[model samples]
Target: MKCNKFLKGISLSVVWITLSICSVSANENAAEVWRFGLEEIEGSVQDIYAQAFKRKIEDKSQGEIVVEIYSYGMLGESEDLTNLTANGTLQLTHASVGILGAQIPEAQVFTIPYLFSNNDDHNQAVLANNPAIYEILGNALIDQDLRLMTLYLEGDMVWSTNKLIRKPSDFAQFKMRVMNSSLVIKTFELLGATAIPMPYSQVYGSLQAHIVNGQTNPIFSIEEMKFYEVTEYLIWAGQQKFTTSVLANQAWYLALPAPHKLILNETIEELTPYIFEQQIALNNTQLAAIKKSKPSMALIRLTKKEQALFKTISTPIRQQFIQNSGQPGQRLLEALDKALATEK
Candidate 1:
């Protein structure tokens, strides 16, 4: 019975039960076991990516590599999971950018509102495998003993509040829930709101109890977590999205054989497009589900002029991100600008 928690989505084949077994290899090299942790539950984009990677690596290595997945709370929360991975207890984890930003401030560069464009392909190239992102930010993370892999673009962050948030002024009366990041706190403050920093797991209950008047998350997350049930309006701010990261333990990654590393990198390359497609589909489906379930909940898609109002105020947040990120932040910012510009 306890094993059910450990193997909730071993293959994610069965609805409630999973039956997966790595084959007994006849290869000379012993099989390597990797523990991968996710920030979302099974069937979410992160889990879908992890499962795909697991299947690919096991097949590519001829069973030389076996990836074991721990869905969300199965192991622990973001901070605990990331700590375990860094300490070599786990090989990999999908961590929230806000949590990662606390230790490696350069990561906070992503907290800057309206950093990425509306173009999906443009965002994907810069985020998924761009040297500008991984090479610049990745090099910095190595000093902290963690290897930055790739960024997962879940969807545009939409706000769920009992009232409409049509402009920055609307935020003044709301206590906005944000991740535990200084940049995020300041971002909300600059937008004229009282930011309540908390863990992701607490958002739903906080909204239900009126502890937090509003929260921002991708539509899929809001619908999946049932945040819509307690909130009255879904406002698409289009300022920031859920851009989490995949990371590996530096020591563990560096110690891996060249062949093993090759497999890991190649698998991630293939997982990128696949996961991106999944995120888009999942968000679209979930948004419809939320609308169907909460017929009275108003959906506010901010006009271009309205979005520009918030985007303009977000400029100071970028400067603050650079200050928080230090020297690398400048280079990282420049690199991102260059990448995005070139994409245009």
Candidate 2:
């Protein structure tokens, strides 16, 4: 009887151990299948970033974490993705600063027209020795249950129009499609154009129908969306240097193991320069392609004086934004200004 009792106890112990092991395996498996989504896949940016992110996650997790990417609005629109991420329904998203700014008004500072004159100027302002600006922006996002993982790429924005935008006066009677941002709407209005806020997906159609005469976008988008086919002129306003952020749901990110998180952060840092290089190359190539394919399309270069005139007209809009965003926006603008000055 003593022997039988001892044997029963040992069997029970073995069963408990098996169950615990299975439970752990299940939990780890659950964490491994990560879902990453992007709004569009029109360029190699999305592809390269996704690949790099997945590789890092997998490597860091020792093959325990696998990331699946959905692109081209496969999951939903940018706003929908933002909401889902905030609620922890989605794992990750890559969105332009415009969409991010709409959600977190402080991000709008990046969208301020002519915020950075050129890529080097913008990189110097945001990239090197700039902890405060990124911290403020990332913290603001974290407050809303999101993590700003990385600033993925910078693309130069220019105005595409059917008419020549030779000077600020040329914009007097123009109507352009602007994103749903008060700053953007006001900027165009201040620049002497009628600003029509619309979804990006609709901009192409609007331009096709002649409902709006012009819009601004990066060269990659102009080539990918075939915007050059509809617009006869491309004015190099460089009005906004576009950037995107890789965001993760806070809950999901927090659930990750310490090693996994470290891996992701490190990977993002390593991949930043490569992504930036590709973006610059693609933008240049697309511009050349547009010029070659559409020989009639004119690329307008604005003089320094003209750019200054445009900025002067748009100053009031910036003031209003500062007033509306209150201290946070004001602080962000101040930080950006300081960074820009330090760069020079």
**Most accurate candidate by lDDT:** 1
Q: How many steric clashes does model 1 contain?
A: 0
lDDT (Cα, tens digit) per residue for candidate 2, span 204-289: 88999999999988888888888889899888875777677788887778888887778777877877777777778888998889
Candidate 1: lDDT of 163?
81
Model 1: ten consecutive residues of lowest lDDT:
13-22
CA lDDT scores, all candidates in order:
0.81, 0.73
* Residue-level error in angstroms, candidate 2, position 106: 0.6
Would you list the clashing residue pairs of candidate 1? Answer: none
